[model samples]
Target: MAPAATSQKISEKDDLDATIKKLASLKPIGHSSYTGEIKSGYSGSWAEKLPETTKARYARHGVDISKGYPYVPEVDKIPKFVNEAYAIRNEVYPYVERGAKADPEKKALFGAAKEVINLTKHLGTEIVGLQLSDLNDQQKDELALLVAERVVVFFRDQDLSPQKQLELGHYWGQVEVHPQVPRISEEFNGVSVIWQDYYRAKYGLHLSFKKAIGGNAQWHTDLVHELQPAGITHLHNDAIPSVGGDTLWASGYAAYDKLSPAFQKFLDGKTAIYRSAHQYVDPENPLKGPKYVEREHPIVRTHPATGWKFLFVNRSMTVRIVGLEPEESKTILEYLFSVYEKNLDIQVRFNWRPTKEGLGTSAIWDNRASQHFAVWDHEGKENRHGTRVTSLAEIPFFDENSKSQREALGLSLD
Candidate 1:
């Protein structure tokens, strides 16, 4: 039987003629239209060239000059403080590991409401079966301490609304309202929306650009450009992609431990200038509406609750070290930045997945002790939206008397 014909009829011959005409009229788009030609030879200009004296200076500072000015050899020799820190990390890991992998009967409970499960040897821990509203005063205090020491804590299938999330943030400290960005809801001024679709449209950003300009695809501490940056950040992902969009956090304590004792001591007295570059409006434009603000903070800051020192400089916000020449600061800052970038063994990567009940994962991280990077690989595929509340805390300070994380954890130097 023949199918019923519609009022509009398609003609194959006419369509073929149109397609042929369009193809014949098409102009060639050269490669140079999108990208510049690649230069084969390097310019030997003084600014572009590495001087012998500069190479020697970097070599004296323990850099591998043969590889390059900023390169450091990956030697098996471990720093004494790093070894001690790891010994401490190993000792604490067993208790957390036992708790994480233990039977349901043997799991450690926090105030009869939550079971603690360590996510990594250092950094993150998952507190299962806990509601923000259900936590008592004692539990809230303990959770604050836990987050301070662990750097970040995770919760699954949380039923926390914006109001409850604000309340939970208040238990630790004052809920921070972002100075520049607006709130997710006008009624709930504390919560900030982190919707990818909204940001992409708002900022006119595209995924094709490889530069770390508009989006947060790089590791950073929250609002380091501010004098008193947010101390803690709690994010609740309501919608996520089927794959990718996982967040990775690196321990500032571990990053600090990887440095040599002499280098660490050198950095103790130094401060770095962190500027509001990527987050502020029109970072690249000099005449942008919002002006950029810069803040200077110690390269190594002590955790007030834990009394342990951790690396504070981040590649995203840190511009230069004070008291050094621009070139010298660039070389040194690049080296310090590589410590966090290269040390994957000291980091934890979390994969986010929502539960069957439509309740997604919520993460609370101590921004003072850790840096995080959002994987932006899920662009245009799915929606990744969330609400965040940042908590205000004290200014970053270093106490000379404070012990290293290793020393504070009671690990022997040997």
Candidate 2:
């Protein structure tokens, strides 16, 4: 009697499986599989497919469109949308200003400077009426803190000599010497000259028209190939073009924020190989034994001061994710690179203009939290020359307990 009952149950299970398979194989009625065309009997109303709760919510929002093909708000009701938008603006503006002013460190330098304007929500600040030489020890300390927190700080109309710029860099850390590039002069004390034409001729650093015209430009964090890359870079442009020589900086913290949680987790445990073979070369001796410097660093590094995680890879320096297949590395790196390149919301573009006193602009940026790209748009037209001093700091490290930029700043993830 037990064997008979088991056989009946098995037959019923087989019948149920066959019925399920048959249902799965069947196509929707009045829909053509080959042409993707709906027959005459099909109404093609997607609204009807929505759940009743969704329909009710839409109705509650005054979005009833069942009576007509296209839904439009009445003329009298259009003003409500405008009023709601203004209401949202009023609600949001204070929070933005509050976030901008939340960093109390800048207030320490309030007496030394005239104005401190935050260039963007996340990065870059321009300090007016403050010269490098004018800063006292306390003001310099506060300025260092501001630069570390803001990632980049700008100064206008300042008569800062090459010697003074080097001194400013030394205030933060040891002044870095370029591995390949030469110093400006023996008198200037470790200031590297970043003259466009001179470097192009001296180092054979030729720029192609194809590269300039290409819509996608590369960005880099300075000296990522070195074992200990530069931390704070002070670039004082002595000469710039009359027009069209702008530099863009993307926030590394914002770049980290753009990644999904799963992707971020995957990246946190990995290290990437950074190489600078193509970018830098010893011009005097072309056949140097070691052509480039290579270093491996964590894919996501934490800022020591801010206690925030930031994306460290750049389009120019980062070569491959270690331990991954070539194709897999290429696919992942390309996507990660695009997070900074494609998102303009997380970037700030600075257009260069000489001061009335004929002094060029000086910008100091933190290499760990920012990547910069110099737009070579003024080729053969104007000379864009500059002197830069890189200050050495701590080696890149990742702390698992560090909060993200958004988390640290109390910003919305959305």
Candidate 3:
């Protein structure tokens, strides 16, 4: 018609569509050769053969050659610190090792030692935090004791930047990125647990079919399935809604203390099964499997540094008692979970306040003595985002009573 309408050549859109169709016919990105960052640390030949430059730097920096130039503190100058930590750690080691019941005095002592040890080791600051470098020695010590005893500490008007947050976490140990996902920025490393709506569009995936975690508002510990779960998690509410998104943390130390002596004895040496069913695996992201697994850990674990014992299971990961009858396991699990759920006085709930800059704030928590839950009561309306940086430490263990005595200043568990 119109000038005999010369056969329209493939338009740019059509060309793109055709090319996309051809590409889609082939294998996806999973088939592509993308060698991302290598998994390292635990084992590697290079670790034994430290780089010449690294060795030279250590020599120049007056670092101890024997300890592989790790950040081992100056123990000679602060012998009391070591004695306190080791003493506490030793006091409860047998209880954990021998599966012996915890006496009321021992339980109280462990709780007390846990606080004192944490305070002593963390340069006398509470909650094992190093955010406020300006803290005086007394303030730091007070913070440590408070955090050790209470298990959770609160902050008001703490204006922390993401960069500062990540930097501060380094004082503890190497930061651990999410094991299976390639989502957050690499430079920030494992500092972020990023979430967003436009992410699906950016990644070119179905929106409604998959969802991000925390978006649902669930109560669980962060990455408990890992052999060494996070010692601490710094979660800042970068984005929050107008109202109704609060996070709560319960004290495991308190939970253990609240138990009757008979119950405490019954839990000694008994191990429970913890599973990894709650970790969010995006279906569209097929790099990892959605399969779940269960792990057996002590019902009561002694803090390796503090020698204090705390109840270890939370509702999210704990599946069952490893050797108990099915009915017994179910009954016990329900009871333990209820202990954490019902105890409100020993918990702290944080309300998110939308900042003027439009980013929400954050809270840092000790995963060792605390369990957390995100309140999903506010979804759809408020845009909440988070970036969490996890820290690695020794597998939580306990110490003997003699060791516990040497750790504190004549402070007994009773």
Candidate 4:
């Protein structure tokens, strides 16, 4: 006779079955109705009151932040989700796990793509033929491998809705819900609103830690302070300007290769301090004012999927190298920052232009192995808006045996 089913396994299966039923019941929220502040930077306490212009802009999305959170008029209609959400993280079984072999021919991925254009030798790839929403299970797995290999991948003119986008996030891994961050709606807290103008207004003084040097500021990885930081991050820009707004991504793998063998040897296994973009008050020492969410991680960390070591430091969040004095750490950190910032050969600039098939474009990147900077050149004058979903992955680790991407692929720095 077969062994009796354990209660835990039986419970998980029951929950999974119930969750599937609930999802089937969830109808497509009207595209426009997908609007509102389920939560946001605007929802919290702030110093400078929101300008009427910003408030008016957000109100169009059903966000009446005028009174604060529970911002929607029909908050009662929004079903309580804390219990439902835990299933995705705890029981649904995280997919696209680390340490899997990559599919080089990309039979499943490019089999559907019309034109696979390599944006640069090291950094970006644009998969022209595929629609993100329509990807099958096999195609989705290949897509994750492609992102790891290319550092980032682009999709043009996709019809991915907010709900479908959130579903995709769940398929990848644990969808991160940062209660403090600005999101599209309460119904979908995982979908973060990426409105530059409004976000700038919300975080004033706190944004200063990201000061510029050689005009190289704001290059960062998401949620590095979390025990398990952001891994595969999808940013779908449903709205963009006619010209002037582009995002730049630097390949962490290429940055590692730029360093000499001696430098690479020194950096390997060394740890550095990374802090959160948000700050919180230290209750024990109220006199200190506020403190950032900080974590110490390897300066040179390995990407589990690719088994390659990449420089993990970012100019914005990674403040200092561990075990080093302040001045010593600053000097070394700045040099490493420049390695990522100054190397044009290791970077790709993507212009978010969309054809008639969709509203805008999407860029899905492996935040664990790349850093991106959004060009704010539009001066907040144009409609450059998007929603991002960041999936939390493994706590970072440095494997001394991991190879550099260039070395592993037999590609020269030249």
Best by lDDT: 4
Please, what are the lDDT tens digits per residue for candidate 3 over residues 50-85?
Answer: 334334333453433353311212222111221222
Candidates 1 and 4, the one with greater TM-score: 4
Model 1: colliding residue pairs: none
True lDDT of residue 255, candidate 2: 92
Per-residue C-alpha lDDT of model 2 across residues 1-414, encoded as one tens digit per residue: 699999999997787666544432332111011212112111225335333432433355354436421122222222112122223212211111111233355565766688888889878888888778777766766666677678888987766666677787777776765423444433444577565554344334456665562111348777776565567888887666788878888888899999998988899969999864322222233233113346788889987667789999887778899999999999999998899888999998887675554566888888877888888788736766667898766667899998898988888897
Q: What is the C-alpha lDDT of each candidate?
A: 0.62, 0.65, 0.49, 0.71
Give all TM-scores, in the order shown. 0.69, 0.70, 0.56, 0.76
Which runs of model 3 end up more than 4 angstroms from their true locations? 1-146, 156-159, 181-183, 194-216, 277-290, 354-360, 398-414
Write down the TM-score for model 3: 0.56
Per-residue error (Å), model 1, residue 207: 2.2
Ordered by lDDT, highest first, the candidates read 4, 2, 1, 3
> Please, what are the lDDT tens digits per residue for candidate 1 over residues 70-165?
111121121112122123212111111111222333222364654677877767888777776677665666666777778888887765566677
Model 4 lDDT tens row, 319-366: 899999999999999999999989888999999887763355889999
Q: Whose lDDT is higher: candidate 3's or candidate 4's?
A: 4
RMSD of each: 23.5, 27.4, 17.9, 12.9
Q: What is the TM-score of candidate 2?
A: 0.70
